[model samples]
Target: MKTFNYHSAKDVKEASKLASSSSAFLAGGMTTIPSMKLGLATYKNIIDIKGIKKLSGIKVSGKAVTIGATTKHAEVANSKEIKKAIPSLAALAEGIGDPQVRNRGTIGGSIANNDPAADYPSACIALNAVIHTNSRKIDAEKFFKGMFETVLKSGEIIEAIEFQVPQKSNYQKFPNPASRYAIVGVYVAKHKNGINVAVTGAKSCVYNDKDLAKTLSSNFSAASINNVRVSSSGMNSDIHASAEYRANMVKVFAKKAVEAC
Candidate 1:
């Protein structure tokens, strides 16, 4: 890693103030540290936001569950409140990388990095999550831009994410054996308003499958989408899986998610 100035920020104000084009705010450093080591990313200053007490916790209400920015994956997986309110979310957290990664990774860092195959973004879309930042709030749909991209601005820090509670929900993924990142993941959420089908890992970005959602909203069953043909256009293809294969897995996992729900 290159030399950089490390600053321990005590609060959001300090963290945001330290932010600049050449600086980064470190929460869990799950992605940041690795990128720096690989020379994929470099920063002049590293602002440690984990010391900011207000940025770590879980809050549950009847209508929504609010998770602080620095809340670790393990914390989310183990929270009784999270399991009770959103079992799918807890399952998602528990399925992340591994014990070390889960214990160290934060929800904020994962979402902010916006890795296409990352699990949290799919949950955010399916659960109708709102990302609360120091400046303003952004809907989940507007928050993710593309692979490794997001709408977060310079000097802005995410404070928390609030997910609307659903009547029923489930997540299913075909994980990469070595990394555990999803090759194809689907999250199905049934709400009073309607149903949401969010898909990830198969494309350049996580997105809601409107066609599947519409179909499921009408029938709410795995068989309803059995004949639904998912197009392979714009899907990622590599050594692990082909675009067509990934497209098929989307449907397969969507059905699994619905069945699991």
Candidate 2:
């Protein structure tokens, strides 16, 4: 790992100021640290946000659940309020990276990383989540741009994520054998807003399938996915699975999500 200067920000203001420079914000460091360690990334400064007390915890209301940016996956998985309001969401959190990662990784880190195969983005997109940034709130649809990319600007920081509790929601994934990252993961959600089908791992970024959404909106059942065709356009092709194979996995997992729900 390359040596870099580390700075711990006392508050959001300091963090934002530090972020304006060519530095990386240290959340749980689950993604950044590994990349830095592998020489895949280099940064002159590391602004640790661990000192910011406000960016942690879970808040639940009658309408939605708001998770603080620094909230760990373990916290989400064990949150009673989240479990009651959105069990499927809690289940998804529990299924993220394993125990150590769950304990150490922050929601902000996961979202900022925006990994193509990450589980959180799938839920965020499907559940109609609103990403609260230091400057403004962004709809999930507008948050992600591409692989490891987001709409976040320089000096911007993710504050929290608010999810509209779905009437019915579930997630299913086909994981890689060694890394446990998803080969193809699907998140399906149904609510008054209608149905949302967000897919990750099969593409360069988490994406919503309007066609599948229409099908599931018409009928919220596993049978609904049987007739819907998944496309390979812009889908990923790799050693784990081909574009065609991954396309098929979406349908299979969509059915499984229904069953799991």
Candidate 3:
């Protein structure tokens, strides 16, 4: 691994100042550290945000549930507030990579990284969660642009994610055998606006299944998805699975989530 200077910031302001150039912010370091070590990423400095107290915890209000950025996946999975407000989110967090990954992978890192196959982004999109940054809050619908890309600006750190309490929600994933990253993951939720279906791992970015969403919005039931045809036109293709296979999985998961809800 290449050598680098390390600094532990006292707060968001200090952390942001250090994150300008050739620097990476460390929350859980579940992915960042490994990428850096493999030379997939290079950094002159590593800013540890773990010491910043504000970036950790779970708080649930009548309006919404706010999860601090540095809070680990394991913590989210075990949070009583989350389990009570939206149990599917906890179940989804519990299903991420493995025990080690869940214990160290923070929701903020996972969503900010916007990994094509990661689970949290699906939940964020489906729930219409608001991503709070040091600078300002961005809606989930506007936050994600593409793979590993977000609207988050330079020196801006994710402070927390606020999820609007949904009427019903469910998440389903077909995980790769060893790595446990989803081959295809889908999150479905019924909100004030409508039913939203966010599919992950099928492509380089999470996409809303408007057809399924419309169907579910009309009738929140598994039978409603029977006539829907999931398209394979823009899905990912590789040795692990074909674009058609991922498309098929999306339909299956949508049905499963409806049944689950």
Candidate 1 deviant stretches above 4 angstroms = none
lDDT of 2 by residue, 184-238 (tens): 9999898887889899999999999898889877777898789998988888998
Residues 148-231 of candidate 1 have per-residue lDDT tens digits of: 999999999999999999999999999999999999999999999988999999999999999999999889899999978899
Tens digits of lDDT, candidate 3, 175-205 = 9999888899989999877889999999989
Deviation from native of the Cα of residue 172 in model 1, angstroms: 0.4
Question: Any runs in candidate 3 off by more than 4 Å, and if so which?
Answer: none
Off by over 4 Å in 2: none
Worst 10 residues of 2 by lDDT: 14-23
What does each candidate score in C-alpha RMSD? Answer: 0.5, 1.0, 0.9
Ranking by lDDT: 1, 3, 2
Better of 1 and 3 by TM-score: 1
Give the lowest summed-lDDT range of ten residues in model 1.
Answer: 218-227
lDDT of 3 at 111: 89
Query: lDDT winner among the candidates?
Result: 1
